[model samples]
Target: MQAVILAGGKGKRLAPYTTILPKPLMPIDDMPILEIVLLQLKKHGFTNIVLAVGHLAGLIQAYCGDGSRWGLNITYSMENEPLGTAGPLSLIDGLEENFLVMNGDLLTNIDYSDLMKLHLEKNALATVSMYNKDVPISLGVLNLDDSGNIIDYIEKPTLTYKVSMGIYILNRKILDHIEKGKYLDFPVLIKQLIEENEKVVGYDFTGYWMDIGRHEDYSKVLEEFNSIRDELL
Candidate 1:
């Protein structure tokens, strides 16, 4: 099978650290986060991998070096300009009838094969892997009536949402919707597909998944890596 790892962004949110090192190259423990992702993909039976890279491209290429150490065929798709997310897909070639795409700076125990299986079984144009995230509201929330009356008051509470894990399995045909050389984010592409009645679906995953795109998340991964090392690796 094939997989595309999006590693191009400048990782503005990650700032000074990213100012010198690409987010994917950030160390999770001993290995770079991208290395972990590559290993996981290899374990899941993906032989061919394409790294969609832009910012700090040289550093990433130097580190990965054709993916030989990991026993995977790695190639790169460089972005001359910043393509939001899905836009980079337009630059990749020879994608399988179906392929997996994911952000490079994440730690997850999701079964990539299973997610692909669900996509195939459902015959979807795209299948998004979702995780149930509990977002805690620190401030009191209010519900007001149309007449400017206080209808309900709720103290700080936790809200649950099925958030995208930044992982996806997409059908090659879906590429028809993407314009080559245009900047298009993944969410916008998915939303367009849904509006057009395409077979876009979601696969809920109850597993450990976190994107280390922020300092806090990066710190959390460092703290949690050892304990969940077995599960993730």
Candidate 2:
């Protein structure tokens, strides 16, 4: 199978580190995070890979060149301007089949083969990998009525939600929804697909997943990557 990795974000939240290296090039146990992702995809039989790059694209290309070392064929899709996530896919050629698309900075042990299998089984136009996330509120949450009076109050509630894991299996047909040279994110595209009565499925994953887009997440992955290296690699 083919896979497209989005590696072009400016990574403003990662600041200084990203200033020199793209977020995907950031190290996790001496290996660039994107390298780890590539290795995992290779292990899962995804031999054709495309990196959609913009910020610091040269460095990523220089480092990953042809993906020969990883036993994969690598190509690049350059985005002259920042294309919000899914927008870059429109610029990639030869996507005439179902393929995988994921963020370059993600750290996860998700089973890509299984995800693709489910997508094919369901015949979905798009299959998003979903992760269960718990967001903790530090302050008390208040509920108010239209009269501005307090209706209910709760302290430090933990909200649970199913969020996109930034990994997806998309059918070539979905490319019809994308406009060339326009910035389009996954959420907006997914919403449009739903509005048009397209089939979009979600595969729930309760395994390790981290988007190392921020300093805190990057630090956390650095601290824990070693323990889970076997699972990922």
Candidate 3:
């Protein structure tokens, strides 16, 4: 199986650290985040991989060349400038069928093989790995009237939403939805697909999934890794 890693982002939210190194190259435990991702994909029999890199591309290229050390075949798809998540995908070549695609700065125990199986069974053009997120409103949110008067108030409302896990199983045909040489983000791509009457399935993975896009997520990784190292992986 082949995997595409969207590692082009500057990760501005993870600044200071990202200023010196690519977010994917940031050390997580004993190894870089990209290394962890490669290991996980390798474990699941995904030997062919692509690293879509932009900022600090040289560092990543120097670090993981041909992916031979991991017993995987790695290739590089360099973006001249930062291409949005789905945009750089258009630059990749030789993707036969459905393959794994994910953000580089994520740590998760999602059963990728199972996700692929479900994607095939559902015959979907795209399958999104999803996580359930609860964004709580700490203050009472009021529904304002036409004149800006409060009509109702809900206190400490915890809204549960199924959000994207920055991971996906995408069929190659979906590339048709992408405009060439443009910034095409995931949400806009998915929205367009839905509007065009395409099937996009969601593979719910509520298991240990941490998006190390921010400091808190990085902290959680260390905490979770300590207690459930074997299982958390």
Task: Give the winner by TM-score.
Answer: 1
> What is the descending TM-score order?
1, 2, 3
Worst 10 residues of 1 by lDDT: 144-153
- Model 3, 71-164: lDDT tens digits are 9999999899877999998899898699999999988888888898999999999999989999998998889989999899999899999999
- What's each prediction's clash count? 0, 0, 0
- Residue-pair clash count for candidate 3: 0
The best candidate by lDDT is 1
CA lDDT of 9 in candidate 2?
95
How do the residues 55-155 of candidate 2 rate in per-residue lDDT, one tens digit apiece?
Answer: 99999999999999889999999999998998999899998489999999999999999999999999999999998899999999999999999999999
* Cα lDDT of model 1 by residue, 1-233, tens digit: 99999999999999999999999999988999999999999999998999999999999999998999889999999999998899999989899999999999989999999999999999999999999999999999999999989988899989999999999999999889999989999889999999999999999999899999989999999999999999988
Residue 61, candidate 2: C-alpha displacement in angstroms? 0.8
What are the runs in model 1 whose C-alpha is more than 4 Å off?
A: 145-148
Task: Determine the C-alpha RMSD for candidate 2 after optimal superposition of all C-alphas.
Answer: 1.6
Q: List candidate 3 segments past 4 Å from native.
A: 142-153
Q: Where is the poorest 10-residue window by lDDT in model 3?
A: 224-233
Tell me the TM-score of each prediction against the true structure: 0.97, 0.95, 0.93
Clashes of 2: 0
